[model samples]
Each structure stands twice: as structure tokens, then as C-alpha cells.
Target chain A: MASEAQSSAPDNLPLVLIHRIPPFELSFKSWLPTRFRLLDPLDPSFSSPQTQSLVSSVRLLLCLGPSPLTSDTLDRFPSVQCVVGSSAGLDHVDLATCCRRGITVTNAGDAFSADAADFAVALLIDVLRRVSAGDRFIRAGSWPAKGQYPLGSKLLFSLVNITDNQTWWLFQLGGKRVGIIGLGSIGSMIAKRLEPFGCIIAYNSRRKKPNVSFPHYENVMDLATNSDALILCCALTNETHHMINKDVMTALGKEGVIINVGRGALIDEKELVRFLVKGDIGGAGLDVYEEEPEVPRELFELDNVVLSPHRAVATPEAFVALQEVVIANIEAFFANKPLPSQIELE
Target chain B: MASEAQSSAPDNLPLVLIHRIPPFELSFKSWLPTRFRLLDPLDPSFSSPQTQSLVSSVRLLLCLGPSPLTSDTLDRFPSVQCVVGSSAGLDHVDLATCCRRGITVTNAGDAFSADAADFAVALLIDVLRRVSAGDRFIRAGSWPAKGQYPLGSKLLFSLVNITDNQTWWLFQLGGKRVGIIGLGSIGSMIAKRLEPFGCIIAYNSRRKKPNVSFPHYENVMDLATNSDALILCCALTNETHHMINKDVMTALGKEGVIINVGRGALIDEKELVRFLVKGDIGGAGLDVYEEEPEVPRELFELDNVVLSPHRAVATPEAFVALQEVVIANIEAFFANKPLPSQIELE
Candidate 1:
């Protein structure tokens, strides 16, 4: 390492560090305030001794995307006072290490809630109504070849008249029993958005929230038992990992659908695939997978499973909102003001 | 024609006429009340000389699907008093003849409304969010090949920061202005469903609905001029036929989306194809075509448009509801009770 004297004099502007891996750099550099000098490790001078000295003095770090911010990485920037996360889920960040180090953490809170909730509803409708499957059918030049696509399940009321050759039915959305997992900001928004569609809402969370009228279940299994659809909106943690196993899925039964807008590891992907393959579960609308960008090949041919490229929070509107929150957190940190959306650390 | 003397004696049950072309017979025959004797034209007895005399005394006709109910056909059943239409749209029936003959018409009333509204919303979301396109991307194994799918339009706010190397964006649904054509039951329900999504709702109809608060326009052009999306929910009548022609589509502009859940002729299919092909309008989610089962083949390759096989009302639940309404109408007609879903002949 070069001597301290080799480093250039610090500018008057406050210094901020940007932690991101290659090909995933921050795209909102111009949107950030000019009052801070952003130190990017990917820069050409990053390996230089003088630049390393500057890196050690980075008091504020902006963690963009899934860039790992492990304890060892944090050790290089010993002066990091606050870590402002630009993504909704901070799984990449070692939150426990940050908490132990007494470093404040902020995330993009409520900024992506609306878009995520909208996507969850979209996925549910897509799976239930077979929107994507119908699109595929039409795209394959199969409409003329195939007289009509198969019908989806009826919404709630059952009028099953089984004749030898004919059956009369209706698939509605007016009264579906929807069980929401993790009734947080995103979950509550999902519930509110689905209310007008006349869906019956229930939830399974860490604890029953006060002033909420929706029925709450202590366990995910019980929630699945009563719901026609289960929307996963909870954060992934040690407790929630593999929470949706075979038993829980079995309880949801053959007519129950699953919509996941949360993290992939929150569910047992292998079990989900098995259940889906066996036709034990009604359908699934997945935006995330256990090993993303590597979805099960078995799901490729299934009509009931709708696969998305983890794009629930990929809306342009959500990004603008996220940018606002990220900027606010940065400004608040520099101005000695409270952060706009700090994550509560346990 | 057979003489009255050659006609067989009337059965104890009331006689009901079923005017359906071959291969399109109603599947709810067993569900029909045993009190009425259904007279199917395809019945082998109908070719018999005495069957013609029996047909003349039929007072109730059940028109199933799109079977033509022309005046010439009605003339064969001169004693027909009530026409119970099992389908929602009455375009196939000669309403003029029905009115002239003072024949009351009952249709599948609110039976199919919920499913239609649900489908309308589903189509709208699919078009706006590009759910079908994204699904296609994942299904074709393009996610790993192509890192990110193209971003859709921003929901409401504008943040155009186009750098030479990088750009930040999001496509949102929360703040879209949705214009509903035809403020009837389906239109109103579509508005109600989209309200929770933070969508701004407006409408165009023949007459302004009382007790309604949404901004209403008398002309569809004015409605399309200000809307990001136009949801066609009006009945296809002479006045409304091709109402969404070139002028209205042009006014909807480049970023506008069209969702048709109503009859196919409500829009000029030829004009729509040109607009969609030229990128004059952003996208479409069409369930009905001008000559359905024969959609414009051009739309098959387009990524923006979502083509559904006129399946908005093809759900089992809708069929069950339709069976209920049909049974109710038939029972009421025989009981001299008020028809459950009568259509007023204007």
C-alpha cells in the first residue's frame, strides 16, 4: 500500500461508497446528490494504494442490487456508519453483522409495495384465468386447430352438474378465499387491492395484527387448509425458509393455487414442483425460484404454472419511487436527520 | 302442411321450441324442467308430417348460443310468446321481429357479468404489464439468454434520464387512466375492480348513469383522447358498431391500450390491425374478433397484443349461472311469473 501522503486532499463534498458487483452497477448515479463524492470499487484506480486509503474512509455505503456486503467486505470499509440498501429484500447484506457493528440500515420501504402487490394480483389472475396459457395457445397457431381452450376452475360458488357428456359451470373471482402470508406493508397492500374483486382475505403472520378485520392463522398449514389461494408476501428468514413444505402444500389441496411474490427460498421449490407435477395443487404463479434463472425444466410444459423472471418489483414506477427513498436516506444521513425508511433490526 | 285433424293430441306438459343449429345444441337439456316438452328441430319426429302441426302451437322458444332466430324461423313457430336467450349478447336474435310480435325476451342477466368483468380486468393487466409476453420469454428459455425483459411504460410520474451508457426505468399500473366504454353492469364492475389499483376511471356511454361519480363522456373519442387504456364493454348495436374506429384509436395515441370483452364488432377489426401493426396504439388484449375463430393472423406474431380465444364467458361458473337464469326464466314463463332477466325491447 502507498503512503498516506500519496493520497490527494479530500474534497469539500461528503464521501459515499457504492458496493456493487460487475455488470450490476448503479444506474442512478446522476440522480444521486452531487453533494457526495461516490467511491466505486470497480473504478480503474480502486486497486491503487491511495484509492484504498480513500475507501477506508467511506462512512456511508450504498448497496445496490444483490452485491454481497459480508462482514469481511465491511471490514475493508471500517468507517461505514450507515448502509443504505436500494432493494426491497436485503438478503445480500449481512444484517446481523451490521446490527452488531451498530451500523444503521435502511431499505427501499413501501416504495415497491404497490407494484409488488399489483404483480401478485396479476399473477393470481393469470394462473386462475389461464391468461398466459391462453396466450401460448394462441401464439402457437393453435386457436383454429384447437376449437377452444379448456376452462379454469370456478371462483367460489360450486354448481357441479355432472352428466355423461355435458357439464355446466362458471369460474368467478368474486368470492375466493385468499390467505396472505406475512401481512406486512406488501401483504396488506395485496389484500386491499384484492378486496374489490370480492376475495375473502385471511392471513398468517408472526403475530395477529391489531385493528385488522381479516382472520389470522397461527400456522401456515391451517391458513392453507381454509384458503383457495395462498399469496406469499413474507420476508425470507431462517424460520420462513422451507416453511411451505409438502405438508403445507398438501393442506392447500388440489384446488388451491399459490402466488409467490416474496423470496424463492421461502418455499420448498422441490416439493412445489412435485406437488405441481402430481396435480396435487391447483396452480402456481411464481416470480421467484429457489435457484433463479435456473427454473425447473418440468415447469416449462405445465399450463397451470406461470413463470416470471423475478420481475414483481421491476416496474419503472417502482424504481423511481425507490430512487426517491434511496436519495432521501442518503440526504438524511448526511444532514444528521432521521432516515426515511430504516429497516428494523432484531 | 299437415291438417289439424292429423296432428297428435297435445301432451300434458307445455311445448317449448329450441332453435339451435346442429353441433351447437344446448347442453342443459337434462337440467331443464321436466314440465316442458322441448321441441328440437333436429329431432327425427320433426321430419314427420304431423310434427309441423305440433310446432305451430309452441309458445316458448329457447335460443341457445349464436343460433339464428330470424323472422322466417320465428314465423314457423307463430305461437311463440317468449324468447329465452341463453347467451348474454342478443345480436343473433331478430329483436325487431321479437318487438313487432310483442314477444318478451329474457337473457342470461348478471349470470355472466362477474366472469366477464374478471376477464376484462385480467386482459387489461395482461396487456399493461406484458404478462403474456414475459411468460413467453421465460418459456422460450430467453431469460438466461436475455438478461432483462424490456421495461413497460411508467405508471404515472415521469423521470426521463437517458444517459449515453445507462438508464433506470420501471413500468407501473397504479396511476394509469382507464376509460370504460359502456357504463352498463360490466363497465361499472370493471371500474369498481380497477379502482383499488389506483387507476383513474372514466367512462363513455349512451347516457350518463345516475348516482355515478366517475367522469362520463358522451362520445368514445373524447374518452380515448384522455385515457391510457380503453376497455370496451358496450353492447354491440347499430349505433355502437365500429364506434372505436380510426379516429377514436388515433386519439388513444401511441401508448394507449385496448381491452375488448364485449362483442367483436364493437370495434373495426381492420382499422385495429393497421393501428396495432403500425404501432399507432401500444397494445391490445382481445377476447372477441370481428369474425371470431378467425382472428387477424397478423396479431399472432405481435408481442404487445394478447389474443384470447373469445373465452371471456367460457368458464364453468358462468355456465352454471347461465343454467340458473335459463331455468328461472323458463319456470317463470310457464308459471305466469315475472321473467327473472327480461330485456326491454326499445
Candidate 2:
């Protein structure tokens, strides 16, 4: 259903500057222009003068894909007061620069939270239960030829006696301390979904969220020490880069598992590999890596690690949701209403 | 925490005929002797004369693992009045013969439900999100070689247009109608866990459970027609063997997923292989098979199915719980109290 105000002619409709790099086109690109007349600078049809004129007049800009949203890009659209991000995580967008410019930013949190959260849980379960490892064993004809894929119980760090190495493969989730790195829309949903499975939920966000009943650790080390699994849900920033290092992994001990869905640089990838290879850490389930597309070849051989392309929010439902959030944010901006998923700048 | 009655001398303790085939040892075998005076004909120490006298005296017997319990085995233990099962699904136990002989039966439902339910949910999420497939792509160096994993939307059967194959990769869990075949302990737990994920739960049990609020279909075919996924949680009895045949798969259609943490013979393995190969069915997550440790070669070629060697209830927590249940049932039977998890003999 089109809002009455959205029915205006192309020239009369509020313009949204489409800021995206090559090969990173916006999802739902075809339908985007139906609501608002889009002004994509990269489009060949937008002559230099026409693009300049539209950029100067447009009050809102849309940042699509994980391409860089640098200060130089923002400089081209000095008139854009609000940046409607097409993703939940704004690691690609220069949040600090946007904050300095007093440019309000709205993310795709409303759209991406559920599916991203679901994927996080999926990865966690896979690693703990050896779901991928078992599938590999079966596909390789090891089930019939190799006799049995290790059915011995694994004593997890979450509920372990470290002195005992003979413990059975527990593959148990109940009564484990699951420390969430961020308590935003995605992390909180993860906590909620895991609660019924008997996980003891806690968190270590930048700032402790108010009124949240989950115990909040002030730092990553403390959280890692107390957690069986560490799930990353916050953004990647200067402060958080390499936040999970050797010392933090040491504190997590030999039985802890780490799951990352936020970004590749959240953990020191090199350190993580060494720990996994040496069996210093129990296991890891990673969706995003320190580098895109190039996963550590070393990881390919380890059954303890699960690697995924950066596609946590790649589901069709998330796309539909992203479109709604983008459309709502733009329309709200023009209507002088509060944006649906605007990020509160520190 | 030994019960006072269990502190008696082994010779004074009541005898429980340990009826098990080779390789089918009790999960907590060593711990069983502390609670009962076990009589096993298969034990070499128990000479044929000792076994004959003990078997005729024992009033209770324990059926461990998935080995068959035939009428011949029952005839040898003429005095046994109750059979205590050490596993949840009793496909191996001959129920009709026991019922005809007016003997009672009990299963390890309490011990197996939580872990079994957790695995079922794990496989469902894995199949739907292509968790294993993504991991495979990354491990195979295909992530770099192949620009993107399909990432297309799969229009599901429950809320679908059957003709349109161009839909996005939904990977959606919310709003999907999940039909559970048996609304027993494990099935109910699965429904509870999925409720937090926003799944619409329904069931197709032998009869509608008295007060379960979820909608119930009288037959598997009707349930398949109306649902997007079918999870088998019941036993593989004669009535239920091959219940999910081609007709049911056709009704579930191209977009439906099936998860079986129950016995694999619950669905016709040959027909399922054909459907998965033809893309006639969406996907499957199986922990058991019609044949032990022998998965079809065709399934290995398809990414749609996730297979786990029959280890659904193999966890330390489950073992600990099973010991508790087994002890409780034996204690209750000897004390003349109702057996804790006794199956109703119809």
C-alpha cells in the first residue's frame, strides 16, 4: 500500500542519493525507485551537472552493500542529513565521520535481526554437535568404511573438569554460560532463542544496557573467562578490532567455543587459527573472516572450525525486511517523523 | 545418594533379567550392578544351569539398546512380568507378543527427550539455512572460485507459488507450519523450542493428545499437505513403517523439509533418495537410516540432506539422566509403586 505522499511524480518526489561502489548494487534495486526518485551518481544516465544538482538538493542518502561509505563519499552529498544504511552492521560506513557531521544514520536492524540471529544459533549448534563434521564423514564414505565417527562425549569448558581429559563427548548445551558480545537487536534475540535450550545468558557490550537482566561483564577477558561460548554480534570498530586476542583466548581456556557473525576482524584471525590448530581452543564457528573470500587454507583441514561466507543477513526474508526499513526511513525523513531504526550516536 | 533398600546384599536383591544382544550394551553398564542383581544368560560366568534357574525367578527384565526382543527371548524368561526399555524408540521390541502375554513395558523417554529434541532442532536449522552446505563451499575453496553461493530465495511449500522457482533464498523459520509426527516427550520439547523461533506447530499422532493446543491432522498425508516441514518423532512400528512414502512426499511438495531424529525406516529411504535427487522434495536432516551406518551414495551427491550417524541421544548429560531413569523404574517396580516411565499396554 503506497502512502498518499509517495504517489508524487518523479521530479516532485524526494530524492535519495544512492551511494554505492561498483559491483555492490543495492538489493531490491528495481523496486527502490518506485517509492522515491533515486539519484545514483554511478549511473551513466546521471550527467555530471544533473548528479551535482540532485546531490546538493537531496536531504537523505542511502548507503547500499558493504562497500566503503567514507568521508569523501559523504562530502559529495553535503546536503544529506540522514544516511539510511542497507545493512544491520555499519562496519563499512564511517560511523565516526557521520557522527562528527551530525548526520543521523538508520540501519537495517529491523530487517536483519531475526535471520542473522537464527544463523548465529545454527552455527553454534553445528560446531558443538559436529553437524558439518559428521556430514563430511558421511559424504566421504567414512561412515561405512571408517566404522564410526567419534561418538565419545566431549567435555565442554562451559561445564567441565579441566583435569579430566577422558570425559565423554558431551555435545551438551544445557547449563552453559553463553556470553553475548553485543546486546542489541541481534544479540538479544539470540539470547532469547537460546534461553529455552537452557543456556545461561550474559553479555559484554560497550556499555551495559539498562534494565537488561543478563549479567554484563565490563570487558572481553572477564566475559571469556566465564563463558562456554562467545558470540559476536556488535559492530567492528577501532576499539573492537583484535579485541579477542591470545590473552582473551587463554582466559577462555581449552574448552570454550567462539562464534562470530558480525565481521571478520572482530577476532585476531591469525591468533584464532593458531589456537584452533594447536587444540588450545575447543572450536570456532565463523561467518565473517578478517579478509573477505580468502579464508585461511589452514581452516579448511580442521573439523573444529566452521567457515561461512559473509552471508548472515543474506536470506530473502531479511531482504524483504531491509526494503521495508529503507522505505520507512526515507518516508519518515521526508515526513519529519522519527526514523524506525535510527542508530543512537554516542 | 543410594536408596536404603539398594544397600542390601547382592544375593538378597531382586533379580532383573538383562536381555540384550551383542554390541547392544547398556549406556551406563558399569553403574547398573549397584542397583540390581542382574541375571544375564549371555554372560559366560552365568553357566546354562544358573541362567535357567535365575531367568525363571526374575520378574523384571531390562531391554538395552536397539536389539530385537523376540517371543523366543520372552519364552526363556517365563517369570518376567515387566520389560524396562533403555531407549526411547522401541522398534526392536515385539510389543504385540508382550501385550498378549500381559506383560508391562517402560521406555527411557525421560533420559532421551532433551538431547534428542535439541538435535532435531539443530538439523532443521542446518538444512533450512544450508549451514553444512556453506561450510562445505568454504572448505572446498569454492567460495573464492565461485563468486557467490546461490543465495537465491526458495519459495516454500506452506506459503508458496509452486511454479515460481526464482524466489529468494528465504532461509526463513518464522511462519512455517512444522508438522510433528509424534507428540510425545521429544516432539513436545521440539515444539516448545521452535515456538521461540516463531514456528507454527501442528501434529499427526496416533490420536490427538487430550489438551495439546496445536492443530492435529488424523493422518500423515493430511499433515504433509498442510505443512512446510515434517519431523518424525515416533517409533518405526509396523503401522508406521514407510508412513512417509511417495504420496506424502508429493503432498509435502518441492519446498518441504523433513527431519528425522527418530528411526530412519520411518520414511522409505529408497523413495526419499529418488525425491531428493529429482528435487521433488526440499531437503532432509537425518540422524538415523534404514540401514545402520550405510547411507545411500545418492545422498552424498546432494547438498539438501544432512546426515549424522545414529548418535542423537549420545551425550554425557543424557547418559547421566538415563541412569537416573533406569534406577528409578527398577526401584519403583520392586517397591510396588508405579514404574516411572512405564508404557501403557493397550
Candidate 3:
């Protein structure tokens, strides 16, 4: 069911429009006035005329996804003040049209970074420890017959180093090089967490941000070559698709690990399989893949890969935070105050 | 192969007898005397007169296991000076026989307590969080699949009042009720480690020690009833066998977890399985079993159990420490010194 906040723009209605919301977005009343209409951008019933009718009543539009608004749709909303998106990427919104109409635009930027970082750490531990393999062994009835499975490799065991029956010395996370593919919101937060673990953070983004503390690499291969763990948190634009191909995988070395919490299309799936099979790279922790609903069955066969069901933001805390921020941004636009996170045309 | 230390004791040299061990015993050198003919009262091999080759050369008899010396074995080691046992349980050794023979008896009272405690805590987290389940999911290729498997529970899914992210807040061990079955060396160490986590530690043993900081319960059911997590770190003696039976399971409440890093016989497996199936108890983490190498397949099928192959002390560090301690205990007996731990005659 559509969230009630998305369905009705209440009486003191400052005239707001919203679209491209999931079924369970944030509760709007907690942070914003009820005078906001958060439209469903992907609503099957939406037509050209209906889009125009909805836009005509709003002073602002909270757009999500990559749906462009045509001139006719803009004509109905003469009082439109701004267009805000609940996503970081603004490719779908008609920035030129909004600028012509003097409508400002903003995007939800860097909000989901910590959630993604947490997921990266979880996946990394899952892969290294073979946590999943032990579970399968018990279910398969191979445990008691075989006694305990042979001790898992000490290389991947992330827990403490136990000794003398009482004192436990934990493994240190400090002093490892971490390669970030995209230096965006998620990528930066990942570096922040790793800092306490004593990691030397490095990044290979499309354009380097000067104000950052991590070393930047212009070449992804160089970053992969130097890093002990390579993280993929970049945007999936056409120019950066399948950036982690066979050549990049080869450069990662046999001891290096790869983590991807971003879009699956950003890595070369066949190349990853080949590298894993050949032991060219140590391990991989992936939350997303090239294809949804059907990942390569071979990925499951490898002991070094940690796979999750695209659930980095599946935590209840992140889910609620997502809704709260999206609704607040929408509300801010209608009231003619500064939007929570505004996007603009270059 | 048996550990090297087990095989190196000189058969023709002065004999050192270690008798009266606990139910769970490992052959480690925690006593003194670097070289001697070591006699184990609990060894099935000790029954035959053919094993009495050290009758003439024996100088010291070290009591380690709880098994008392039978007249046949004592007659064979006439030159023995000391009978030292490195266990709290003196059930296997005859203290009167040693006293009559004018042999000093020693015990290794609490060397393994802290390690056992650490093991209990690890098992609890492993079972409840489904660290094993997550491992199995990846191995089965059911990850990220729709209608696949019961996903592992997040860390803080049951906290009563917490606004912060449960995942982050509950990941660390703090503010949890941890119940100890026996307030022995291991149980006390568990309480110490859990104390830093803000855990309220409680114990149910023969009688609570006056020096311990943790609270005491009169019965096993009371301990289970009050604990958020009940840890079985007690020895498998007559009074404690099957202590956590159906009634204790019922008292533990549906949210309480049980961890048995001690002897598995302390918990009733049949009742545990029934409780797990009916959702009558929260969960359990087991290392040892009532019957070794004969675990039921049904236990693996349950989501509430985490099984370790009785290898909690199998860490390389622990192995090294065991070798050192067991060797020293044996050597001290040969040197005519006071044993590290002495067992009092009942």
C-alpha cells in the first residue's frame, strides 16, 4: 500500500508533488507539514494528462528515479518552485526544463553511506570466516559423521586470537591499504570506519575531490594493485560500467579481496569468476550482481566469496531513516525553505 | 596422532601417576618433573598387569584425573613420592590410598576456567545470530533469493528500549543477563569478561562462593528463568547431569539462550530438540554432546542451535599453553616439590 503521506496533500497544502517512492517510504508528519503531495513516479495509472494535472497543483515536485518531465507537464504547474529527488543520481529528472522554469532541484546525497559501510564489513567477515559453509555442513548431515570440519583457514578467521585459556588477543585491522572505486558518500564513510582499523585508504573515482584525506588514484588498476581490499561504491554511469574486468582483476593480486555494495553492472562477472577460479584474487564480498534473481551459480561454489541479497540498507534503522529524509526534503520544497539536499543542472 | 607431549613421558624412568580427572579431560602437561613414567588411572590400558613395567623404577605418582588408584595399579608403583591431579574433580583418584602411601597430592584447580568462559560466550552469539546459517545460505546458493530460507537474525532484534540502530548497538556485548551453571574457575572468568559488557552475572551451583561478585540462584531452573543467556560451564558430575532438563528449559523463557561449552551431558538433548521445535526456548549453542560423534541430524535442521565440534579450546594458542602447563605439573612431582594445586581429602 502507498504510504498515506504520499497519497494526500492536506489543507494548508503548500503545493508539493512527489514521485518514485517505494511502498513503505518515511512518515512525513514527524518532520514536515502535511501540506505535501508525494506522487508515485512509477504509478501505472500515470498518463501525460494526469502528470500535468498533478504538477499544476504543486509549488514543488519531489521526483525520484530517471523520469523526465516534458514541457506540457511543466505548463500545468506554473507555480512550481523546485524539483527534489529522493536519490543521489539526478539523471532521470529534466534539469534543463526545471532551470528554464526557475525551479531549483536537489538530491538525497550521502545519507545511506554508513549503512553501506556496515554491510561491506559484514560481508567481508562472512566471506573470510566461511560462516555460511559451517551452517550448510550441519544441515547436510555431514558434521557428526566427519567429526568437526577441518579447522578453517586461519587467514580468514576475523575473531580474537585466544590464548592461555583466558587471555584473548584480537586480530588488528590497522595498517592495510583499502582501495575505494568510487569516492562518493558511501565510499567516504567506508574509509572513515576503516581508519580505526589502521587502513591506508585510497580511491579511484571519476573525478577526485580535493578536500578528502585519502590518496586518489587516477587509474582503477593502480588502486587495485596497491590495495589489500578493494571496495566498489561508485556510481554506475555508462563510462564506468564493468570497470572491474579481467585486467583489473588480474591486477588485484592473489592476496587481495574485493567488496561491492554498489550496482552489479560495475564489475565484470565473467572475469570475477575466472579470477576466483584461478585464485588470482583472494576473496570477494558482493551485495549486488550483474543480474538480479539469477546470479552465476558458480559464485556459490567458491569458498572465498561472500554473497548477500542486496540488503545493505535492509536494516530497520536505515529503512526508517530513508523515509524520514525523503519526506523532509519534499516538505522543505513546498514551504519555500531551503531543501534538505538540493540537486542542480551543471 | 596424539599430541607429542603425551607420547614423550619416559616409561622406564621414575613413575608419576595422575589420577582423579573430571568428566572432560585432556592430556596436557601442567605439572612438573620433565621426565618420568606417567601412569593414568583413568586410562583403560591401566587394567592389564603387562602395563606395570615401571613397577621397579617408579619414583613419583602424580594424580591428575579424579579416578582413585586401585590396589592393583598402586602395588605396581611402590617408589612413587607424589600423586598430583590437575583437575578440580577428584572423583577418579583414591586420595586415601595416596595418604596411606605417604604421597602428597596436588590439583591444577582453575587453569582452564577463563578459556571455558570465553568459549561459552562465543557459542551463544554464534547460535542466536545464525553465524552458521548465514554460512549455509551462501553455500546453498539461496542468498538474495525470494522465498529462500529463514534469514539469520540481526544482532539486536529483541532489545526492549533502544532508539539507536540495534545492529550497531547490540553488536557489542553489553547490558545482557548471563547465567552461569557452576561458579567454578571457568564460570567466574565468564562473569568477569561479561561484566565489562554491563551484563548482570548470576550462578547456580552447590553453593555460591562468598568472594564472587555475581548473584547466586538456588536452583538450575531459577538461574535459567532469570537469565537472558544461560551458560553451561560446570563439570558433568552426578548432581549436574541433565541439570537443564524440561523444567529448566521451560523456566528459561522463550527469549533466553543456552550455551553449553562444557560437557553436553549437562543439557538433555531430547528435551532441547522438543523445546526448539515448539519455540519454547530461544536457542542453544553446543560444543560437546551427550554422545560424542553421534549428534542427531535433527539438531542441525533447527535454526536455534549452533554446533561446534567440541573444539573450543582447540586454538593453536590454547594447544601450546596446554603442553606447557601439563609438562610443568608432571616435572614438579618428580622434584619432590609441592604440586601447583592440592586436592583435600573428603
Best by TM-score: 1
Reference-based lDDT, each prediction? 0.81, 0.81, 0.61
Angstrom error of the Cα, residue A107, model 2: value is 0.8
Q: Write the per-residue lDDT of candidate 2 for residues B1-346, one digit (tens) a residue.
A: 4686656778776898887765545435465677677877678967777556676788998886666899988887788889988889887888888899988898896687988888899899888888888899888888778554334222211122224432224467878899999999999999988988889999999988998999999999999999999999997788899999999999999989999998989999999999999989999999999997899889986777888888777766776777678778888889999989988755
User: What level of docking quality does candidate 2 show?
Assistant: acceptable
* TM-score: the better of candidates 2 and 3: 2
- Give the per-residue lDDT digits (tens) of candidate 2, residues A60-126: 9888766688988788777879999887788888888889999999888668788888889988887
List runs of model 3 lying over 4 Å from the truth.
A1-35, A42-45, A48-51, A56-129, A147-272, A279-285, A303-305, A317-346, B1-51, B55-240, B255-259, B313-318, B324-346
The sequence of per-residue lDDT tens digits that candidate 1 reaches over residues A246-294 is: 9999999987899999989988999999999988998899988888677
User: How well does candidate 1 reproduce the true complex, by DockQ?
Assistant: 0.38
Q: In terms of TM-score, how similar is model 2 to the real structure?
A: 0.91
Q: Distance from true position, residue B207, model 1, in Å?
A: 0.5
How far is A285's C-alpha from truth in model 1 (Å)?
A: 0.4
Worst 10 residues of 3 chain A by lDDT: A163-172
Distance from true position, residue B87, model 3, in Å? 11
